[model samples]
Target: MTTAQAKTFITLFLAMLLTSCMVADSTPDNQWRIVDEGAYAADVSADAQLSVVSGINNGIHVWRFGEAQPLFQWSHQSEGGDQSNNLVANVHISADSLFAVTADREAFAIWSLTSGEPIGFWRIDESSIRDVAVSDNGRGVLVGRSNGKVMFFEPESGRRIEFLGHQERINSVDITPNGRYALTGGNDYVAYLWNTDSGQVIHTFTHPSRVTLVALDDEGRYAFTADSQQKSQIWNVQTGEPISQLQYIARQKIFTDAVFSKDGKYLLTGAPSRRLYLWEVATGKQVGEWKVAPRENMSPPSAVVYGVGFIDDKHVLSVSSSGLAELWSMP
Candidate 1:
């Protein structure tokens, strides 16, 4: 990064600190539920029909909308200990909601959503797992590691392909629902859209700072990549061209989670300061904005939006670090 970019990043970081320190209720109106009190991590399926949450007290639990009881409950065994002591730091569910992955620092476990069974558990050899994603139908798993390596593994066939293009530790990763493509961002200030079959790069997206987050459209039409600084852009998945960069009044708007609309017309993003935004894909305009609630007894009065998905053309869903599942009307 250049000196100019470094100055811009510091300005943005201080702005975020000032905003987060404020006490206010920015939450918009919504129907909400307490899925898990003090959730450690959470994720929602692409269709918004299913959710998985891990709390401080228990293992991971998967819930179907409108159902009081969780559909499945599973736990990852902590290193040198039982499942009861595991603290899952990351959780991801497939777009089809057929599979989920839960991980800590050293290992990750894959689960089948339909039968509520543990499919497999794997431990990293020399590197720690940073993030993980499962392909629809449980055919593929993508694991980003702390040692600048990404693994594309097949559970049934026992095949593992490594993507070693990154020069620094990986930060985030996502896989296409069909398991054909992979997107990953890293501290190296670059994001790659690559073929999972051949381990080849199709497109490279560069940034001014470390790439913090990334996501892929379920239909493989678009890709979203954001850095720690001010740059957040969407790209054409087919043409490998830049589409539009998101516009914000702040020095920067850091996204913690993001998802593309099914029709590939809009993008939804969530941030640390209880912010949720809807952006027009073609024009890169801010068409809608909403905020999720912080925990009731929290000091800072802010929540990090962990997961977002479209319920339909008219509704949307979000899961937050606040341990609440909220349903919002489309704006």
Candidate 2:
């Protein structure tokens, strides 16, 4: 082939293989791009402004979309005294990227995303916290616990609201952008949504087995739930009616985390199967699947992913039990 023709053909192939938006039954494996490391992330989340990761490093870290390094990090470990090695279980960054909240084994804390300074901290009970969610403006924080209680903390006025969220330990939780509605999933075979102000259960969505994760779209109009039996369902928040039920392309897998895209067009799922799956929220159709490359020297067959989220419509972040944290984007 002519030199110019060869160059043109190579460029087209590279574009097709490198971008995350490649429309296929499965996204291109060549799209893999390891953007960050060092922390074994337990949960990863983002909004338009910032991306956050948390895990066994006993802290949460934040970064802008294209930056190679995190702007700041917060740790649960003591600086000097007892050297308590605490693990951060979950974290969420608000949509505005103004603040972030985290849940450790014993306490929940909020931090200023711009300054990297903590805004507030609270201790609810002896049981470790399981998950946390923050509002877009950073004033409201929802902290879920292993004891089945959901604690709402208002950092500005120092107010707290406690709700009996579930009969079993809470596993996942999320809040709407306006901070008016929140969703929780627990060891119980159910998911619950509550009016944050009145502290009342507005809807109860039951499953065949324990609910492992729950999430809401940016507008708070749609909710997603994944249960232990490998079923994932989407519902209309306003009506509490079933919208779409997503089935795994393969055998049943234990879902660890799930989230909707910023615009609510797509859904993401993480499982111990070492695979990440994306679906169309409107049709419940599988659009993409990316498996974490097997770790070096590890004999296990799967990567055991614990968390998955969209940094935006074009990028994806993942955290695994094997200490793998990475980012992939549409080239």
Candidate 3:
């Protein structure tokens, strides 16, 4: 063959090989369904039985894993009975799946999972609500605000506890299944594990940049904290000591959501780049990894992994901003 023809052939082959690799990496080994076509946000219950999604219009829908239709549809409305103009930016289901919490920037509402009805709705007056968590059975509610305060409230008793440790906007928060302890992170570059009743800090985890994500193991075994920069560490909840740091080769690996295994042996984390990772709790080694598919005809061909949970010992599930729900076999 002529030299020019040989060069052209080599370039074409290289392009084909790159394209094939991209396709393979973006496709999951197993996908369950497209839970929501264009959901703004989504969250999965810790037991993996149900999922809650926020649609473009800020309406909320709850779906059982095997069901085709959502069990409930709800929307936040104004006092005049008109739909609120704000979009629902976050939705989380309780560990027991008995209730869920949805929050836009200015308000949050609790819903009953069984009856599919609103339990109560509350509005924030000072600053926007950045993140929220509901303990099992909806006995306790926690919200992190843009004004650096985290509030833990009981709907039945009208008791409230405000945490004023953070000096900057609160970014993430989680509570124990029993609603005893709370884990929170903030733009002040700190993660605090504190008491829900006293609001006294138990342990302070410092980071180099803003702490963007924090999670507590439902069993109270471990705590996971990550910053906007490169540092991510797992801590022993009882001893208040660092267990191990997530060892990612990337300079920065930002986690949008995380859940611990029931046995506390493994952790599942989701990232904004459609990346889901399974890590060993003791070693912090990445044992498994998967990439979720992007939205159809997306310009950048990327999706944010909104939530992840363990379906069972052998399988894990993830929901992405692309509105896709997938089940994956653990490695």
Candidate 4:
């Protein structure tokens, strides 16, 4: 072959090899089991024993792993006098207690999962709460509101502890295991760490773009945040030092939600484009990617995955904007 032809052939071969690698890296080794469909929002508990999903006619449905149906259902609004509710934004479960925030800027309510009765409800500021995080011990709860505020509440005492920080809508909030510090991320492209007891801002980290999500590791030593710019960062919680940054393929828009595995060895991130990525915490390497196909029976994809959480190191729960929830086993 001519030298010029040989060079062209070599280039084509390399291009094909790179394409194959990308495909292989994105394929999932395990299958996704759909637990629920048509859910607007969903959350899995820290123990991974329960999942709460809300959307449309479904209100809030609580399910335990391996169960065929929901253990309990709660609605905010009544339909046909049958007690139907709508517009649930978030749900959280701790032990036998369940907490939910509705779409309307009204109140946050708590319920007893065992008895299926309302335990109590607290009126939050008339701003829509977008996300919430509960302390590992379930003593403290942090609510992120649309009005750029983080409200700390002690669920057991029904007392509001603090209202502080953020100049724009808070997208996510995370509390450390010991309940000493809380982290808030907002549309202002900043993430702030605050002292839970004193309600004081300890340090603020700026991102290149809007902050979409924030999470703290099990040991509370590392803080992770991601933005719409497809960049994920890790910071040393104690010194407020940047540890590492990972970039993903950019999309038109990405709802970046991240979680640290139970072992704190892996970080999982979900994007808008039906792709989920797992990263190694120590080496900052991409370990796996799961590709979810768009629902062939529907007009669009199953739904843009809103959040991802590790059930253990081997299993994960992914919730979509359309309210479809799934559990995947990681290899």
Could you give the C-alpha RMSD of every candidate to the true structure, in order shown?
6.5, 9.2, 4.5, 4.1
lDDT of 2 by residue, 1-331 (tens): 9999999999998797666444232233222222233334455545533556664434566655456566887675433523353566566778666878776677767788778887766666657788888988897898888888888878888788888868989888888877888899899888999988988999999998888888888767689988877678999999999888896544455777777786778888877767788888888888777776554466754466666767666878776655555565633
Model 1 residue 236 lDDT? Answer: 93
Indicate the TM-score of model 3.
Answer: 0.90
Once superposed on the true structure, which residue ranges of model 4 sit more than 4 Å away at CA? 1-37, 77-86, 94-104, 136-138, 156-158, 247-256, 293-296, 321-325
Sort every candidate by lDDT, greatest first: 3, 1, 2, 4
lDDT of each: 0.86, 0.72, 0.87, 0.68
Top-lDDT candidate index:
3
Model 1 scores a C-alpha lDDT of 0.86
Worst window of 10 by summed lDDT in candidate 2:
26-35
Q: By summed lDDT, which 10 consecutive residues of candidate 3 come out lowest?
A: 20-29
Please give the distance, in angstroms, between residue 94's alpha carbon in candidate 3 and its true position after superposition: 1.4
User: Residue 228, candidate 3: how far off, in angstroms?
Assistant: 0.7
**TM-score of every model versus the real structure:** 0.89, 0.80, 0.90, 0.80
Positional deviation of residue 262's Cα in model 2 after best superposition, in angstroms: 3.8
* Residue 16 displacement (Å), model 4: 4.1
lDDT of 4 by residue, 1-331 (tens): 9999999999999898778545432333343333334556666665556667675554677777656777788765432332422356666554223443333344566566666766555556567777776664457777889898788888777677665678898887877765568889999999999987788888888988889888777566689987767567888888998877764443433545666776777878776667677888776677877765443356754555655777676777766555445667786
Model 4, C-alpha of 70: deviation from truth (Å) = 1.3
